[model samples]
Structures are given as structure tokens and as C-alpha cells.
Target chain A: MEQKSNKSLWWVVGLVVVVIAIYFAATGSPNPSSVAGKTVKIGFVAPLSGDAAVLGQEMQKIALYRVKQINEAAGENGTKFEVVYEDGKCAGNDAVNAFQKLTSIDGVKFIIGGLCSSETMSMAPLADQSQVLVLSPGSSNPKIEGIGKYTLSLSYSDKKTGEDLAKALSSYKKVAVITEQNEYNIGIRDTFLEDIKNYPSVSVVANETFPKGTSDFRSTLEKVRQASPDAVLLNPNPGVTAENLIRQLAEMKAWTGYKLFGQLAYLLDSGRAPAGNFTEGMIVIDAPNVNSPELLAIEEAINKDQGGTLNDLGHYYTASTLDAVDLITSLITKDGNDAEKVLNDLSRGRFKGHIGDIAFDGHNFVRITLSGKYLIQNGKAVLQSEQ
Target chain B: MVQILIYSFVMGTQVLLLALALFLVYSVSKVQNFALGAIGAGIAYALYFSISAHLQIVWTILLTIGVSVVLGIINFLLNERLTRKQEHLFALLTSFSFAIVLESLISIVFGTDGKNIIPGILPVYEFGVFQIPIPGLITICFGVMIAVLLFFFVHFTPWGRMLRAIAENSFSAESSGVDSKKVRFLVYIVGSFIAGAIGILAGLNTALTPTMGFQLIIMAFIAFLVGGVSDIRGTVIASYLVVLIPETIIGSLEGVSLNWKMVLVFAVASILLGLRPNGLFVRESRKS
Candidate 1:
């Protein structure tokens, strides 16, 4: 009786181990849905509620609109494209959580967005480990390019934006620089300084670094005003610094003859400063505007379909998401359920996108023209003459 | 130097808020309420929404405090139910879980996007080389006021003495006809409310993000650990010292990244914790 019981127990344990092994084998790897008739899931992650929520919501809206349009135009193998929204919150740990959730719960074949660079940085390692394809819509940090073979950025580097700004301001003799001391701001400042080194005629009159979320600018502005440069280049986000700095500059009567230039950080439309008049005559280097004929058509169609106009920043995210969907669909059509094949196809081809043309180099870095300088005139941002 | 001082003060205010919450709960319940961070974050979210909807700051602050009180009461009741006969570890786990739930709830409601409280800058007051913002000054004032009130309540009030008794020996206080459970609930509510109000102040000073509370909580924990978790004065002083040391050093370290400073802080804290397990100001055990 004891021998029989021992044999029965061994058999049960063996059966359980086999079942567990089978489960792990079936679920551990990335498996594409039925390529013939099932709905294709495209995952999107963004900061939807914290300090960056406004931008994230805008991105989500645009992405959803684009997915709707894609599904309407060409049903992928008689299947519709569905977007699964994941909240990244633009933080490291949160981005990882969102990535895991999307990969596990939604079973997304392709993913778009990881809006902030920090978030992209955090998700990159996991994406590589999971063999998941991720295309960042607005992650411009140079560090992201080295993350993995599957990660790609639609946005250009800070270096490119800085170079564009330097070219735009080549005619100016003296320039003052004010930048926040955060990574993003520092990246732009360092790039701008490096690029400006090439211009012998321009002198950096004053340079000041302030903390991120700094609420007051009078002292910094006073220091900059004392230097009395022909132009002031600020690398802080437009939220508080731009509004207050501009207002203070106007109050100090420093805006009369001086030109103000900023990076894409000053592109937010707070509706407080209408037409960027306080910022008028200001030059900024940013992602290409969605005001072109093709973009306008797409925006119009999106608004008609979604019942609202996409914000300026939202358009870029929308374009990136659409491009990502197109790339993924094309890949899956060519080779079903093979992550390697999909990655190879994405790396090998050049795709035309709403933002511009996109082609990945041998290093898996997507080469895209995302740097352009625009002039803020009478509260409107117009492409610079050179651009 | 002035900028660093101002930033330090602002950072100190957040630290004090967290320290005070920890102090209050530890003094009355003999259990550290780790949910202080969640309370603060929830209040911040409430304040942000209220301000965005065109409500006055005063009213927003009031609403935030109210929400925090509600959360604290719920936490107390739930903790009481779960930890009635369990070990201290159970209470700690329960509070930790509560914090997670609150954080996740905020995430679900607010979405993952970080919202800036207000996008405009406060005008700076310049006094030669000494420059500061009116908002930063207000935060300092708020911190001081809360600390003063807390001091008076703990030292002068009869209820405070009863709370002290309960913290010293819950069974003895209960045998003396004091309702230890009620005192625990009151302490939690008051502590959480203070944390919540400070959260609003923090949101005003910087930007409001869901995870902003996480950093502040760590700083607060450090302050509590350094100052002696049982002593309010010690905690407050430790909070300011912790913030000031880092700010002063980081300001002096030109071209050395902030990440290096954070690493240094962690290393120092690990050493300090090793040397002084009960913190700088160890509380005397009455029964012993």
C-alpha cells in the first residue's frame, strides 16, 4: 500500500510540472494574433494625468484618430486596428509598469509612444528583453538611441534642434543664454553652446542656469538684462518661465529691440499669451509644424472623425503612431508572429510619414527630419525664411 | 547662494510636512503611518482639480484637508480591523497597502499624465543678492505655523496627554478609561490633514505629478529617521538639516550631475541608519 501511494504521488507531481512548463512556453514569448482575421492591437503609452497629462491626452487623441482612419482605409487582413492606451505617467517605474501591462494584458504586437525621454529610457531595456517593438513619438534624448534594436524615436535629437537654432541666429552678434538645470534643458543648452562655438562672430554675453519648476525670474532676468545682449536664448519649457520671463522683459522695457529665441520648450499655447505677441519676433527650433497641406488635410479628417481639433503637439504624436501602425501592419503581413522578421523589416525600409520621411540606419536609429526653426510673429509661429 | 537657500527652504517645508505626519501617528498610535505620502498626493490632486475649475486657493485647500481627513479615518478604521490581534508587521503592511491603493486610485482617476498646477511664474522679490519668491516664503510660513500648532497640541492639551499615554502603553491607558482607539483615529486624521495641506503647498511650489509624493515621502522618512521619529522638534530640525546639506553641497558641485548627489545621500543615509537604528533622538520607553 505504501509503495502504491508513493508511485501515485510521483505521477501527480510529474503531470503538474509538465503543465507548468507548457504554460510558460506558450505565454512567455511574444505571440502575434491570427494574421488572417483577428484584430491587430497597437499599444500606446503616455503620461495621461500628472504634470505632463495635457500633452499625453493630446497625443492619445491624435493616435486614436489616426488608428480609426487607418482601419477605415485598409482593414489589415480583414481585421481592424485597435489601440490599447497605457498610462506611462512619464516616470521610470511607471513606464515599466505600463509596458508590462500592455504587453501582458493587451497582447500588443507593436507599441507607440513613451512620450518623455526618461520614460523611454526606462522602457527601452524591458522592450529589448521582451522582444517588443516600441516607437517613441516625442522622446528626443540621444541616450534612447542606444537602448535596444526594437526602440526607435520619431523626434530628432537635441543636437539637431540646437544646430538649427544656431544657424537661425548666426546673424546676431551677442546672445544671452538662460536654461533650466534639468537634463532636457541641459541637453539643449549644451548642444546650443557646442553649435555656437562654430560661429566666431557671435559672443555669448551672459549664461545662467536655474532649477526646473523655478517660479521667479526677476533676478535671472535682471542679470540677463544687465548683460544687454542682442538676443536672449532660453532653453526652459514655455509653461511658467516663458510667460513670466516675457512679461518681466516687457515690464523692464527689454523687449523693445532684443530678440528672444527658445527651443521647442516654448511652443506651448497657454491661451494666456495670444498669438505669442509677448514672444513675438522670437525664434524657436521645434518639430515640423502640422500646418502643411498634407498635415492640414489629415488634421481636418481627424477632427471630422473624432469631433475635435488636435492640439499642435498632439499632431506629432498622431503622425508617429500612424507611422508605427503602418510599419507594424506591413511587417505582420510579410511575416506572421515573427518578432525578428518584423524588426528586420522595420530596420531595413524607409517609410514616408506625416512628419516627413523615416528610415532606420544600421544602428536601429530612425533617421527623421524633425528640426525646424519658426518665428513667432504677432502671436503666430511661422517657418523661418531659411527653413 | 540665495537661490539655493530658497530652494532648500521649499524642500524643507515638504520634509517637515511628512515628518509631522509621522511624528503625530507615532506619538499616539505607536505605529508609523506610511500612507502619509498617499494622503499628500490625494490632497494635491484635489487641489489641482479645484484650482483648474476656477475655485479659490483657500477653498481648494479646505477641500483637500477634508479629503485627507476622510482618507485618514478610513485608514484608521481599516487598520484597526486588520491589526486588532495581529503583529506590528501586519499594521505596517496594511498601511503600505493602503498607500499603494491610494496611489493607484489617483493614477486611475487622473490618468498617467502629469498636470502642472499653474503654468505661470510667481514674481520674484529682489533684495540685492538675496532674492526669493512670495510663494516660497508662504510655504515657509505655513510650515512654521503647522509646527507651532502641533507643538502646542502635544505639550499643552489634555487630549494630547491621553494620546501620549496611549503611545506609551495602550493597555494601561485603556485600563485607565482612556479610549485608545479614538485617540488613534484622531491622531491619524490630524496627521493626514496636515500632510494633505502641505501637499497643496508643494504642488504650488513645484509641479504636481502623481509620483511627486514618492520623493517627498523618502525625504520625510529620512528626516524622521535622522531626527528621532518620536520627537517632533528633532524631526523638524533634521528635516531642514537634511535638505540644507544636500542643497548647499549640490549647488557648490558645479558640473557634477544631480544623480551623483542622490547617490551620495543614499550612501550617507545607509551609514547613518546603521550607526543609529532608533535615530538621533531616541524616545524613552515609559514602561521600561
Candidate 2:
């Protein structure tokens, strides 16, 4: 009886293998191009549904619109572009899985996104190994600099903004810093602290850090307020976390008598400003919202079909994302859709984009560090000046 | 220092309220209502909708409480049906599943982005060196009132005595003609209402996230365990100790990381429990 059972088990195992083999044979290997045509398929990873879904979905919309526009105005080469989207959920592990699925199953060479810094960084190692090009529209963590040869970001690093903010706010004698414990926010916090140290007058009165997903920060803010800092730096990623910091600061009654300073995340949207009057006159330092006539035309085109302006969700991100796509497509156009050749060309090329004249240094770091000073006036973000 | 104490009191009240709410259900049902936080999150979302719909604060509060009562009744019915055999672990699992479902439902309705019911800088009233926000003051007052009311209700009221009787021995309470099921259902409604109130207070203090109540509930559970899990007074006291010590002493330190707050909580709990394995508050007679 035992011998018969062993033989049956072996037969079952063999049958399962045969079934899987037959299924794969019948369904053929995964293909990048959804359709049979001369198409350059690009895998797009974005947080479709999660904490950062609003921003990610908006990025997806812009990417799709860009793809559609490219297809509509197919160049002389007749190279049609296709974007296959996978949800990264604005998380690390999810992005790794998405990256694996895109490269292994979808078989795409070029990819766009991993909008969040963590998502982008998680996939950097894999992308670097696979020699896949990852051009991010949103990741701004200082650590992402020289992460990989194929890894490049359209957004300016937080290191530059943090140092700029430190110098900008150095006039204040005392400053309190509240930061999120994420790679991106931590990068800003650390850089800001390092630069602020150079100014003897600017003593950091309180430096508080909250874990990611922590919305209740009243106590932390209370402690910060107790220090009576002349200025406060609230650094967190845009979306819920930033909004919470702003709102909680208001609730702690810590908004009065202190200069509120923020970074690029705060510049994403003014609707996120604490409603009524708390955020009035607050200053945020970010990349210049460089919009040209051509950029405005693209925005108009996008708004026509997207039912809203791309800047409604994210201003810099939209411009940078457009730049990312344009850069990739331009590089692909010049280099014949080869990922390695595109990287080589991008390393040596200076491209003009919607965000302005964009160029990468030898290490593929964006060189145009033009920071803009945005003031919250009338509950809206307006560019006050170029810093 | 006064500000740190104010912070502790305000934050501790939130934890205490949640602990008391959990204690109410646990004492009666011997089942940990893991959905306590989800129920609160649901109410917070309700408050968010009401505020978005331009409802007045008074109306929003009423609407939230009403929604919470409905949710409580649903929970009571579900728990009654699920644990008809009084299987504690099965009931806990059912509650956990219910929590996940409710949390998902909240996420679907509210989206994952956090929202503030009160979206502005709150005015602070200063009395000498002590500065207190209106919401924090309100939370403290409400917390005190609720604590006093709970103390009186559990000790003096006939229904409270019935609840205690059921907690001690449900079979004996039922033999004495006490409607244990009815009393348990009422406890659920009250506990859930308090949880909803805490949820709104928390929202008013900060912002509303689908998982906002998750940390609060975890802290409450820790308080329950540390406080002997069977003593009402001990749970109340433990909630404040667990929150205040870590938040004020550890969190307010200049260089100490906020990550250590949880570590400190567990360390303190371990120390106290190691000294008294049963619990900090368990009576010697009960152990025997």
C-alpha cells in the first residue's frame, strides 16, 4: 500500500509539471508590446493605490497622455510607443516585485517611474544589475545620487534644497525641525542639519522625527513649540504626511510667532495648506516651476483630455515627468531604442525640457540647481522670486 | 515642563479612553474586540463626511455618535453570532477579520490620504507658562468626565453591577435572572460611542487616517496587559503611565530618538510584569 501511494504521489507531481508546461506553451512567453507592431514598449511603475496614490495616478495619467501624443504624432521612423503600467503602491517591496514582473515577464528595456524615493531606490539595484534604464520623475532623495549608472532622476536632489533652505533661514536665531523617518525626508533633515551647523547663530532648538504614516503629531509639535524657536522646518513628503504636519502644527497653536519653512514637497500643492490662515505667508524653497509656451501648450493639451491641469496634482513633478518622458523618447529616437546607448547618450547630452534647460553632470546628477522661493499668499502658492 | 505634562495629559487621555472602551468589552465578553480601532476609524470617517458636507460641529458630533451606535449594534450582533459557543480565540479572530474589512471599507470611502476635520491653526489659551490648545483642553475635560462617569457606572449603577456580575461569572449572572446578553450589547454601544468620541477628538487634534486608531488601539492593548487586564483602575492608570512616561520623558529628550518610545514602553512593561508576572495590579487572592 505504501509503495502504491509513493508511485501515485510521483505521478501527481509529474502531471502538475506537465500541466504547467502545456499552459506556458499554449500561452506563449510574455511580450512587451500589447499589440503586434513596431513599438517601443516602456514599463511604467507608479503608486496606483496607496498613501501616495493621488500623485502616482496623476503621473500615470501624464505618462499615458504623453504616450498618446507621441503615437498621434508618430515621427518619420514610425516608432510607436507603448507604456505598460504596474502599481508600485508607493512601497519598496511592491516596487521590486513590479520591477521584476516588468523586466522578466513584460520584457521591456526602458521604464519610467517609481515616483516615491523608496520605490525608486528599491528598484535601483535590480535595474542596475539588469542594465535597465529607470528615469524617475519624482525621487529627490540625496542618497539617490550615483545610485546606479542607469538610475537617473529629473527632480533636483533634496541635498541642494536643504542646504539652500539652511542658508535662506540662517538669519533666524533658533529653528525647530520636524521630519518624517523616510529615506527622502531623512535626507533633507540630515542635510539641513549639516548645513545649519555652519551658521553659529542658527541653533536647532528642537529636532523631532516621526515615523512614516504617523498623523498624530500634536505632542511632538507641542514639545517643539516649547523650545520657542524663531523658525520651524517641517520636512516630510508631499501628500498626507505633509498635510498632517501642517494641520497638526495649526492644532498645537504653534503657527504663531514662528517662521514656517518647507521644501519641495510643500510646493507640490497649495490646496494642502492649512485652510483659513495658518499657512499664510509661509515660505517654501523648491525647484523653479519653469513653464514655457511649449510647456503651457502641452498643459493645455493634457487638460483638454485629462479634464484638469497636470499641475493640479503636482507642479514640479508634472514638469519633471514630462522632461523624463521627453528625455527618454529623445534619447531613444537618437539611439535606436537601445537602453545602454540611451544611457551613454544621456550621459553626454544636454536636453532642454519643460522644466527648463536640463543637463546631467558626469555622474548623471542634474546640474541646474535653480531654487525658487514660493510664498503662500491668499491660500495659494505663488512664485515670489528665484532664489 | 508644564507643556510636556500638558502634552502627556492630552495624549494619555486618548489612550485611556481607548483602553477603557476595550476593557468594557473584554470584561463582559472575554473577547478582545480587535475591531475597536476600525469602529473608531469608521466614526472618524463619518465625521469627515459630515464636515465635508458642511454640517455644523454639533450636527457632525451627533451624526458620528449615531453612526457609531449603529456600528456597535452590528458588531454586537456579529460577535454574538460568531462566538455563540463562547470560543475566545475564534471570537478574537473574527474581530480581527472584521477590523481588516472595516479598515478596507474606510479606505475605499475616504481614500488613503489623511484629512483634518478642523483645518486651521488652533488658538491657544495661555495661563502663565502653561499653554494649552482648545482641543487638548476639551479632550482632557471629556476624558476626566468619562472616567468619572465610568467609575460611577461600574460601581454604583445596577446595570454596571450586572455587567460586573457577568464579568465574574456569566452563568451565575444568567442564573440570577440578569440578561447577560442584553447587558453585554449595551456595553458595546457605550464603549463604541466612547471610541467614536475619542476618534473625533483625535481627528480634531491632528488629522484622520484610516489607520489612525491602529496605534492608539495597540497602546490601549498594551495598557490592558500591563494593568493586569482585569482591573479597571489599573488599566486607566497604566494607560497614562505607558503614554506619559515615554512621550514626555523619552520623546521630549533632546537627542533620544522617537523610535525608542515603543521600546521604552515594552521595556517598562517587561520590568513591571517581571516584578509581578500576573500583572502590576492582579490581586494575590485571584492568582490562587
Q: Which candidate number maximizes DockQ?
A: 2
lDDT value, candidate 2, whole model: 0.81
Distance from true position, residue A386, model 1, in Å?
Answer: 5.2
Candidate 1 chain A: minimum summed lDDT over ten consecutive residues — where? A268-277
lDDT by residue (A1-387, candidate 2, tens digit) is 999999999999999999999998999755443332367879899888766777887888788888888777875556678788998987889999999999999888888988888889999999889999998888888888888888888878888888888987899999988888877788888999999999998899898887777766766777787788999988877777787678667655424788988876677663356645777788988776676777777777877877765654556678888888878876675566578888888877788777777778655457767777889887777888875
lDDT of 1 by residue, A132-175 (tens): 88878788766666768878877777667777777777788988
Runs with alpha carbons beyond 4 Å of true place in candidate 2: A1-41, A49-51, A75-82, A87-89, A104-107, A251-257, A309-314, A329-338, A378-387, B55-66, B285-288
Q: How many backbone clashes does candidate 1 have?
A: 15
DockQ of each: 0.10, 0.35
Residue-wise lDDT of candidate 2 within B71-108, one digit each (tens)? 89988887886555788898888888888898888888
Model 1, span B1-288: residue lDDT tens: 565667577778878878898888877655667888888888889878887888887887678777887888888876775444645677777787888888888878876444556555444556665555555677888898989888888779998789778777788999999998788888888877888877777766555656667677777888888777666777887788777676666555544333344555666567656666666666444575
DockQ class, candidate 2: acceptable
